[model samples]
Target chain A: MRAPALIVENLRLKLCADRGDTTLLSDVSFEIQSGEIFGLVGESGSGKTLTALAIMRLLPPTIKATGKVIFDGVDLLALPEYQMRSLRGNRIGMVFQEPVAALNPTFTIGTQLICAVRAHHKLSGHKARERAIELLDMVGIPEPRSRLGFYPHQFSGGMCQRVMIAMALAGDARLLLADEPTTSLDVTTQDEIVRLLERLSKDHGISVLFISHDLGLVARLCHRIAVAYAGELVEVGHTDALLQTPLHPYTRGLVRCVPDLTQIGVLRGGIPGTPPMPGHWPGGCRFQQRCPLAGNGCDDAQVTSSLADRTVRCWKSAASVDTASIENTTSPTNGPKNLARNTTS
Target chain B: MAAASVSSIWSVVLHRLMAVIPTVLFGTILIFGLVQIIPGGAAEEAAGPEASAEAIAVLREEMGLNRPLHVQYLSWLGNAIRGDLGRSLTDRRNIAKAITERLPLTIELTVIALILSLLIGIPLGVLSAINRHNRIDAAVTSVSGLGLALPEFWLAMLAVNLFALKLGWFPATGVPSVELGWHEHIQSLVLPSLTLASGAAAAITRFTRSGMLEALSSSYIRTAWALGLSPAQIFFRFALKNALIPLVTVIGIITSSLFGGAVLVESVFVIPGLGTMLVTAVLQKDYPTVQSVALVLTVVFVMISLVVDIGCAVLDPRTRR
Candidate 1:
């Protein structure tokens, strides 16, 4: 896939302290093909956000990361801070979670966008401002010129998210990392943002690393899905294949938890037990404690293997499943019952 | 567009003016009432014990000291509106003339002190914030703590002992005369200004450090850093201005506190300013001189607060709405 646009090789991040360290992300690796939306789905504290932060080199002073983040043949981790800064908004951009609080309250939308444009390029203020207006218009903001003078507080949540998207596209960034971009918006706004992002990705051919806990939304927007469970990637595959036949038990549970509108009189479900904290990860498979199909062999670290464009990190996936029984029993209407039985047993 | 911005500025100014008027009026009334309640009278001070009883009565009548308190207060207010502050009891000079002569020196000293505070305080604050929990921050915090501990008068005395007595770098007392050039006058003003500034500078540094720390951790700052803005740009363009909103509030309070600080610093430095004049007026129970000076000071304090409110509105556009 033309060098996969961006690649991470065995990334490990540790939260450092004066006394000791705690591992946040371990042996995490992934690659993004050009013009593809890759979903990293996990709940909060599952190291999904940490992985994005490590890729962007935006980790706090206390975080120590070890990995090779190769983007467009350049090793991002090895680059000097100054050069990395120049590459950030120019080649790679980020849309953070909260649209309302993400923007600087003191600056107008135009001023901030202009600053973003001028940060990477040596453009005149007038030129940058013109580009800002154009970018705002491109993001579907109505009357961009008139709204240029309005502060972030004047904009609604959806409008602010659009402004954030405009800022991300200000310098024609090649890769966009949207970190839970729609988590703070209304359901309708969430749908609008996802649609807009999909259209932008297709039109510009920009690769996006879309991070969210909402598997359903990820299923719609992303071409590939990487389900993260307790800081470990348990499954990675095409969105359709992964949803149709989730090999990893964690991925199966996540898929089952998605509320199906077609199945009436069905209760929505959630993953049983919270993910383990950073310092207290279980040995071997990180999701073993919570996996319904966990066996004695599951305690041994199993190597990830790929078959027909799908990769699963599980010991039981190697053995064949009774496809008929698995399919017939695992109806959307019976998802909650299965989840409840699994948790009890 | 320019007209709109100007009107916005005016709107802020008007709002601030409205807030300050009552405070100023309240201060004036309190000061006037306090002077009236004090033992002895201006007439007694003007006419000595050796003077005839008839002469004392005449002086008291002329000054309206025998009138009811409310009547005296109203008469004084009416005269003040017309720019008549009556005559000083001791020197027989027009109270307004005396105040005007002293006002320049006090304002000059205050301005110098404020400049010193900003010059030293801001850098110290920035440095402390940048190196939070490190040796630099610790040192700055300790120095500021010490500055706060030492009273203005004691600092002035220490400066006099070190610079004037020990180093022989400056004169021990008195202000430079009008014959001296502005530069020479400024040199004479420096020591007193720095002494007066120490406490304010320390307070400002502490406030600024906390403010900058808070601003640096904000989401916008993180976004700015992620946008690949240079540390300099992030610090100055994003963090510093955001920090200044809180710092400016501290500065406003400190500037008003300067009047109280000036009472001691001005006396210790022995400069011919309002502090010295107020002291003399108080000792002689010179009601007109005391009331006029107090009224002027209250007006200045209110005016400063008004400017600060306007500055806040301009700095933070959300306040305008």
Candidate 2:
């Protein structure tokens, strides 16, 4: 088995406000194998980004996190901030959603990239700059040396994302936390960025925790996928297996939401209800309000139930297989249900 | 790349300099126009109230008050452009010479006050922002509020009483001669300059605190943190630099306004700076000197703003374009 690059166990986040503490994320646990791309898919406000921030120990002062984030057998959560600094960017690099905003506007790409290189490497400015240029070229930034002095505003969204990726890899980071790295780009650029990330992960043997709201896009890149609903992971399995026969109701709903160009005149209604606000989730299953398979047993939730090769949180996972008629009555609509249906045969 | 940026900087400076011309013109005209509307007759004030009507008329003619307003303005502007501000109507002393003698002292006081405010304000602001909503933030915020509210003259007097009289840590009045040595000169100016700085420092603290708070919350600062930069590096290299763009405007405003505040402080301390000279000129109805000093102060204010714009362009590359 490939060595585990990062493992998070029972991660919980709470916002300690004057009113009271609001539980933001509870019991978020996942593992990423070396060189594997693990997708954490969820809607906005579902705490996917929060998970990444928690891992990095970058949450705001008011928000508190308690959990073990073991990286390379060392518990990151237990480490002092000074030790964490040594590991962050050097071992665990991050790429934010907004590429333009992620970079300091006052500095040039060369300066920013060189700073990252020097942070952990203890290199001279010239050496750091050379390495920065090398990294830019590796990320497909043309004429890297010439573009070094260009500011973030001078670069396009796609180029900025590429620069951000290069900077993330500047310290030879073993694991990359990419928080919707391509969310701001167009479809064509998003595909290019996905391909680049996939290639980089394969070549460098770097593990990546890719967080995104789009299942289709995540499926194109991630090796394993975890579905988050209201700050809790409801399902985790191989990407194709999860997409084809999603065990959790929330995962199935997400799979069904992916756009299908083959199905004409079929209007896809997105997940019916908005995700519950933090501190307002139902006592049992957080997704119960929107789950089509929600039933009596769902009132009392169970921790993830391990099936043959998947972990699903839903109480109705076993009954869901026999309830084929219920799934059909909801109207398949526009979906890559074709892809899953094709896989079924 | 250096050559290109240098040329671009020059172009920006050129463009800014072009913009300043109109502002300077407007400022000069406004000063000249406003002095014209003052209630007292400069000739009568200069000749004395008992002077005969003929003598008053002769003085008015000599002073060019009988000339067309525009003609008078143009001649004054022409003389100003040539650095000849004309003699004071009251004492017949050369206004330009008087200003030349006093300008450096005023500039020194204002500069010291500005430097003091920046050194005090920026660090306190950063500290306040970093400890936002905590006791330190509250203390700094409330003290700055008091600084902003208290009148400058009252603060000056209080400072003089405490430091000069009670504590005997500083002199109460008059700047030291250069022969007294640089340290003594600086020391003697401390009370007046500190009093002048109090309000500006308070304003700057507020602006810098808010600017830094916003900058600290920015995604870039988060990126800096993620990049494993030390807290000091993240604060000074990233957050403070980002905050400085907006802070520059507030500083520019404070620097310009300090010249005005210096007028009162200089009078209280008897520093013999431009402010004191301006006060003397105004009290004696020395119109040429008053007009010249106003013009000089306005020009200084305009120049400070221009420098601020250029500084912003340097700090934020996007503004360079």
Candidate 3:
């Protein structure tokens, strides 16, 4: 085993306001190994984006973060904002979710790219321009030299996504945080972006912390996936193992919610009920309200439980999936589809 | 690409210039018609009531009052186009010459006021927006509110009383001639410009604050922040450019209004600019002087508006179309 690129140890964030201090991320913990594509998967308002923002130290002033965020053996949380700023865009880069608004509308693509590069490195103007062109080309843009003068709005949505990727990679960071990078894109662009990101990570040997609500995309791209629910990391395991036997009830719920490509004609059902609001979480397992296997035992507090090279945060995991096998196993098509998507991309 | 952009810019500039013509023409007719409707026509006002009917007839004939209003307008418009605004009825001085003499001082006052307003307004506005709901924001708001509430003439008089009469830091009234050198000229402009610019500055501060607030909250700004560019870079480079687009339009309106605003401000400060000249000519019912000054100011406003439109297009590429 190698040192992880990032280790988020019991990270927590609370929004401090005059009315009351609301804990947003309550004891979140995860790690991304060097060169690994780690998926931080969750639904909306589950504090997935907040965790990414906390790692970047880009959270709002009202939102206070605590606990360790060690990147490559260095404690990030302990760094002053000045030092943290140097790490940002230098050792760590981020691609925001909305491609269109991610760029300064008034500035040309080349200017922004060059700025992002030069902000970290002491490159001369000529060298910075060259770097910008190379970055753009790396992101699969055509005629990179000519496209330099074009503004953000001049580019199509897909093209803008490429430009944003170019900018994020401009600093040559070791870890990349992509916050739902493909959510705003069309399906074809989303597919292309997924492939691009995977290829880049492989080629550069850079770690990617991909935050997304789309399970299919996450399943396709990430080697290891962490399921988050209501500010809690409910499950973490290798992709195939987790899919074959989703240890946590929430993970099981997510696995079943994925439409079986084999049974397309059959109606698909979603996990009922929303994740509880951060502060208003249930007294026991956060997912118990929506877990089908809920029992008196489920009412007990759920904590991380290690079982066979996987971490599951559910009280009834052994009985639910370990013995009977995953409910999603009926689809022989499921495993291959995810594998195929990943390989092709 | 360079050639194409240059050509496109030409087209935009030409389009803006073409737009100026109708605006100036419409403005002239409106000003002329409004002045004619001021109870007594210029000819009658020039010829006192005690003057005999035959004397009044001759005065009216000399002033071309007997002609149809449209014909008179066309002739006056033609003279104006040819740079011959006839001569002032009261003093027989060339109306154009009188305007040209006062033009430089008025322009100087306006420019100073504009620069001062922008210098004070933009930073304060950006700061207020950045620190919204804080003490600095509250103070800025209150000061701007005070500026907006006070009348320009009252402000001018008050400024003179405080800064000039009491402090003895400036001349009490009237702008020095250009021959006095740039220093003296600038010195004379301070009080008048302050009085004229404060109201517009107050408004600009509000517009800038609101525009900056909107830009600062935009997703691009958030992206900039996330990219780890310092807060200053995100604000000055990213947000300020977007914020200035709308502020440019507001400034254009403000600049155009300053020409008309000079009338009261000049009177209060006793500056012998076009505004005060126009006031004196109006009181004496100098027909040519009044008509020509009004026409000149209208054209100036149209020209300024065109420039501002182009500036907006430059600042915000999306507005080019």
Candidate 4:
């Protein structure tokens, strides 16, 4: 009976840059259920950050967006910016990757955290300050009351991220948009932050639209994951199903690129050519030029067909030949330990 | 670490103030030596043309111009230390008395010019930085460009023509007498102050625009926008504070230059400020008046630099350590 926390349907964006008008997000559609973590996986220049910005309506002046970004049954695109301002950092929170930079350097953690709290709430300054301490404690920061006065420079990388998490939780937000929250931290710090974010999402019953380029980390944390290539969604399904049985060639290429410890002396295979330029992309299949097994009909009308529980966008993907060898050979290798190495690689 | 506590800041300020002693000594010597080397005798100017050569020689000895250069300098420096710059050679009026009388008027003009430049320059910068390529931004840049192109003297003439002779809104040239009301004094300063502020305001505008642009694009500003702070709060609280740090240095430089700039503007308006006094003294070879004005300007300029440095440390916590 309840609507999903966020549903983005046919959300497209184009950048009117100095070069020309180019599509940044082509018909990107997905939905995140409440209390679930959905992953958006992509390589750099794949429009992952752009899609996140589109959800929050934070795109730059050079970019334009159209279609529906429905949140809790309200079409966000239709809401005025005055209304949107209240919704942002209130019902929907955001945690950017560079935790130190994401906070104002001049402001103390307490001041910044309290500002986020009081932005939407009508609490007294004292009450807001108390709430800021509480939020810091909730994010596992030690001695919250004393540490509140410290600036961003005083906190370690991991502690800074914990502060960012506290900031995201300030308004009791229902949906959190995390844009590569761990990309700037080290492997150890990244692991701690990932666990903290996952735990907070569960404890708070908040849905997260997690965006990252690390397939290994996404597989470990997400319930459902979608793969984006060259500003286009190529595959979508359950994390286990999509990675284990990749229906699209681009998805298969990404899966195979994850280093497999079982196959020694093999340094991982990369997708042959670079992701296509925006305005210069050939018509038909956007991936056809990169797809090795491209046949005559591969250049024909590229369609997204639902295969059991997964969606694949390709003409030849419907009658996919044997790719069991890819699944069998490509792995997290030694499971979780090797997965961390794949991220660094 | 630039993180400064109260005691540390006081110590730093104290240290900077002590350095002013040597600077004053060196600057006074330089000014006195340069004035002495000029190709004319103060005795000729002090005495009338019809006076005998014997009268001029007596005047030179009485004025201490006939003494050895070092002996003259020592006596002058000793008298200067006692707050007595002696008497002007040409007018025989006490130089210190003349300075005190004109000091307030010059201070008032420079302060008004300073306030005008900051008011016009900073906001125009913020507007242009935010609007970027819009019509208002283009207009602001072009206006500042015009301010840069037209020297203060030329601008002063045009202002006198437009607002004084043509419109008769302000007095074209004059300072208010002491008995005049405050508004009369302010009204007289309008054209003169505008002329003095134009060039300095142009420099301030350029610095403010670039500083504001940099601050606006910084990560913290994006964070503020992402956090949904109102545009006003984001600008006044976050972006403006960071933008103003660099502007403090610009202000210090401008303020010092404005002090020097007041000289010409004073001459133009015939206000009898220290600038006019210095010009008259230099033309008539009155050593005491020129040397005293130069020393005072130097000391004041250095003091302003100190204040600006301390102001910056206060505004930005990172610089304090």
Candidate 5:
């Protein structure tokens, strides 16, 4: 079997402030296989985005990061600044959330795209221009050559996003990191972008580490999902298994919060409280305060367990309860009895 | 496309002219009113105190001060429209002729001062922004602050005392007249130009430093760096271009101030420029000469501001709308 494309091992990050140091990420680890889409789902400030920044070494100067981000057998965190810069647009690419603001407003779309292409490779001006037109065409831009001189402000939001995707693909990168790429778009544009990204990933065989708070969308795109809460990974498993039965309470609450269009009168309930602050995370399970299944042992300083292929950091998942009955309570209200029947089946 | 470009240029010029009309009118009215109100009219000075009242009356009639205020203004305005600026009371020569002879020297000095300011200020600003909060930034800030505080006349005196008298490298006074060779003429201007440029350099350096610091923190600069562009590319293509909008506005203001500062520097260096002419007119109360020169400076300032505005619109597309 081929080695995993990317491996993040025991990554930890601390932000140094005037008051004191606050831990942002704690011992997070995951792996992405070739051509696989790995989803990291968390609420805002749960260290999901920080993990991406750490992998890219794009964190602010004051933060202290310690970990091993090994990609194709090379440790990214250990490379010098110059070598890391060389590898940034060549080996790895990133897509930010705000498509409109991500591009330089002063430059033409062609110039912006050509800059990215020439940044990693040397080519004559004519060849680079031809390549830029080809990339824009590939991203479904109409009249690529005619539109070459148009500035970013002239393009609509959806078209700007297409231009951004073309820029990200300029250097033929192997690993793509997309941080909430569709979060700022409208629903129609969001669907269109998702379809485009899916096609690109399939056609190019690019491994993607997709970060988002929209678990429903991630469920459709990602092969494997890691649920993070309060800077710690609370659970990790196959997408289908985790969606069908989330062992961690935080994951279950998140799945329950997805709006159901079929049930119009009933409002979906969200997680009761916000994610814990950085330095003030509760002992034992960080979700104990919000977890509906909290018990005496939930407050124990150390808790860990495994259920088949899923790893969960909850004391309750290991309890002696009727799994079938509990699984039914967590299912979406639309298909109430299906959960009951799946456990027995 | 040609039509579009022509229309756009036309619209830009129209808009700039409209914006400056009020300023031009206000400046002209204030200068004319101030010169008229000053005691000891040009006629009184021309006809000495020893002259009889009848002789003074004859001098006033010839000078056109015997007419009503409105008539006097219209006559002067008509002469200005025809490119005739009347005659100077002291020298009995054409005011326009006197201005043409002196204006070039002042303009040359101002241009040299502007070049010096840009050359020294922009680099110091870039360095200060790059090394923010370091020893170099602190030193530059403090030295520029001191330069601003020192009076221009005092600074000129000190420069002459040090470079011209003590070192014997340059002449202490007496500007090289037009009879001198071009090279000697320029050399004579060096000390005076430096004296005026030092103050402008100080102001520009402070402005550039602050503008660059703001641009460095902008998101676009960060985006440029993330795209794997080198530091030099990021500095020139992203940060510096954005920083120029603010710097350009400061340059316009500095250009206007140069007219006023040129007066003192011109006197100290003894160059026969408009500054010396204005000083002489004020002492002798030669109303026509002072009013004409003041009107010309106001017009020049309005034109410069219009040029700066159009330049900004071209450089930044967002401003065009």
Candidate 6:
């Protein structure tokens, strides 16, 4: 396996408000290997984006992050702000959700790209312009030299996303924190962006922490998948293993919810109930309220236990060696009633 | 590409310039109609109460008031377009020549006042917005609030009383001719321009503060911060440019109002300006001079608004659409 490029250990984030402090993320630990695209899959408000922000130390003033985000053997949480600023675009780049809004409307694309290029490198203005054109071409923009003078409004949404990608890559960063980069794009553009990111990772050996709400897309792009429920990662494993037999009930619900092509004309199903809001999460297991196979044991504190190929955070999965039987009992045919009966007996 | 954009800007300028014709035409009719509705006829007013009926008839014929109202308006408009505003009834001086001399004074006063407003207001607003909700912000906000509430005429009178009458620092009346030297000329402008600028400065301060606050929270600003740009670059280059877009319109409105306020300000100071000329012309029933002055003021207002549109387009390309 490649060396871990980013290691986040026990990253806890809390929102300090006039009312009280609300824990937004708690005890979130994960490691991204070099050149790997690790998918962070969850519904909205599940702290997926917050995790990325916390790692980058970009949380707003009221939010407090306390944990060790170790990169290159140094704890980033303890780094001085000036040092962090230097590391931001030079070593780690970020791409935002809204492509068009992410660019300054008044500045030409060339000026913006040249600014990004000259930020980290000591290049002359002419050289920077050439580099910017090359970077635009690298991102597959047609007629890069001519399009440099165009403003953000002149470009379509997909083209704007490509420009945003080019700016992110202009810094020659090793790790990219992409937070729902394709969420605002159409399906065809989404596919193209996904493929572009895949090729970038393959060519440049850049590690990506791809955060999204679409399970099917994440499974398709990510080498490994971590499913977060509420504010905690409920299960994490290889993409194929997690897709085949999701050990945590929340992960299973996510996998089952992916829209199927053969099931056209049938109303696609979604996991019942919404994720709990920050500061209101139930004690013990956060997902017990929504889990189909939740039993009396789930009311106790959930523990992350390592299995042969993955880690499961459910008490039922940790206690049983026969995960296949547990999975079979929780199938749609058996449903929650049968699983609850089996757990009691 | 540069040529294309330049040509497009010229086309926009031409279109805007064309739109001004109907506005000016309407303004002329309105000015002519308004002076026509006054209590006494201009011919009788010009001839005086003791004048005989023959004298009034001769005056009416000479001034073209004996013709129908439309014929009188049309003839006046024709002469006005040819740069001849006719002779003033009271003094018999050429109205256009009188205007050329006085209009410069009013334009200078308004320009100085506008510059003072922008210089004083923009920095204070940026400071307040940067330190938002703090002691400094509250202090600036309250002070500008006080400035806005004070009437310009009262302020002008008070300034004249204190600075001119009591302090003996400035002369209260009569602008010095340029031949008197720049020092005395600028000294003469001090009290009147300050009074005219106070309210507009306050208004600009409020608008700039709100606009800067809105721009500071925009998504592009967040992206700039994430890009690791310096604080100076972020605030000055990114935030200020966006903030200036909305402030341009506010500045335009303040400029037009400054011209309006100059009338009161000029009267209080007894300065030789278009405003003073307008007030005297109205009182003496000088309809030719009144129509020309009012038309000039309207055209100025329309042109200022046109500049505001082009300024916004230049600052924000999205508005160009």
Give candidates' CA RMSD values in order: 2.7, 3.6, 4.5, 4.6, 4.5, 3.1
Report the candidate with higher TM-score, 1 versus 2: 2
TM-score of every candidate: 0.94, 0.95, 0.93, 0.88, 0.90, 0.95
Error of 2 at B262 (Å): 0.4
Tens-digit per-residue lDDT, B129-213, candidate 1: 9999999999999999998889889889989999998998987788886677776687788889999999999998998899889
What is the lDDT, from 0 to 100, of the residue B180 in candidate 4? 81
In model 1, the Cα lDDT at residue B2 comes to 35
lDDT per residue (tens digit) for residues B1-321 in model 3: 445555666778999988888888898788778767777666666677677778888988988889999998888888888999888777778888888999888888888889989998999899899899899999999999987888999988988999999998888898777677878778878998988889888999999999999998887887776667877888788899999999999999999878778889999888999999999988887766888888888888887888888887777766655
lDDT of 1 at B3: 54
Model 1: how far residue A254 lies from native, Å? 1.9
For model 5, report DockQ: 0.39
Error of 6 at A150 (Å): 0.4
Provide per-model DockQ scores.
0.61, 0.80, 0.62, 0.42, 0.39, 0.62
Evaluate residue A26 in candidate 1 and report its C-alpha lDDT on the 0 to 100 scale: 81
True-contact fraction for model 1? 0.55
Better of 1 and 2 by lDDT: 2
Clash totals for all models, in order? 0, 0, 0, 4, 0, 0
Badly placed stretches (over 4 Å) of model 3 are A318-345, B130-133, B285-287
Evaluate model 6 with DockQ and give the value.
Answer: 0.62
Docking class of 1: medium
**Which lDDT value does model 6 have at A87?**
74
> What lDDT tens digits, residue by residue, belong to model 4 across residues A152-191?
8778878988898788778869998999999999999989
TM-scores for chain B, in order? 0.94, 0.96, 0.94, 0.91, 0.93, 0.96
Candidate 2 Cα deviation (angstroms), residue A237:
1.1
After TM-score superposition, what is the CA distance of residue B179 in candidate 6 from its true location, in Å?
1.1
Which tens-of-lDDT digit does each residue in B259-283 have in candidate 4?
Answer: 8888888888888898898888888
Query: A152-249, model 3: which lDDT tens digit per residue?
Result: 88898889988988877777689999999999999999999999999999999989999999888999999999998998888899988887767776
